[model samples]
Target: MNTDVDQDDCWICYRCHKKLELKQVSVLYLGGRFEVELMQCPQCKMVIINEDLALGKMLEVEKGLEDK
Candidate 1:
């Protein structure tokens, strides 16, 4: 889990405008797929990727794929 994200805090869904729930989801990036826990809307199934995960693990994975 990314330390930057506050798991206790509740997030609102942008699409459905409902409360978001923390869930493990699979995301595709730069032809690679990985699973990460993120905020998601149960209604619309929209996933939210915070800055920490984007700049941290996801970026690292993307770079690794690109290098290969």
Candidate 2:
């Protein structure tokens, strides 16, 4: 999937009003952990997962794990 949002674009944090930084984050799902690049707030450490990652790579991983 293609995203119109630029990868370098600055994102704002809704909770702390701080700039969101792109960082490598670990996601846990169904007893599995995976790492993906995501936007996160520095102060709150809140990670934002986009639709493409959630529905694409993560979904594929989930299905693979379930099938095992």
Candidate 3:
């Protein structure tokens, strides 16, 4: 996925109030772990899990993994 951040879509870390940068983030679901480029705070390592993702790809992956 092209996680290249668009300035309009930029996110700030809730805890740090810092701009989140694109980095490889570890995601876990159903005992499975994988890395995907995501926006997160460099200082706190906090990741963004937006609504589109929660109801979209992430949900799809979770269901697919659970069916395994």
Best by lDDT: 1
**TM-score for each candidate, following the candidate numbering:** 0.81, 0.81, 0.73
Worst 10 residues of 1 by lDDT: 1-10
Residue range 26-46, candidate 2, lDDT tens digits: 878888876767888999999
Ranking by TM-score: 1, 2, 3
User: Tens digits of per-residue lDDT for model 3 on 1-68?
Assistant: 53444546768888998988888788886677867777889899988766676677778888897788
- Candidate rank order under lDDT: 1, 2, 3
The pairs that clash in candidate 2 are none
Report how far residue 21 has shifted in candidate 2, in Å.
Answer: 0.4
Q: Model 3: residues >4 Å from true position, as ranges?
A: 2-8
Residue 2, candidate 2: alpha-carbon lDDT = 33
Per-candidate total of colliding backbone pairs? 0, 0, 0
CA lDDT scores, all candidates in order: 0.79, 0.77, 0.76
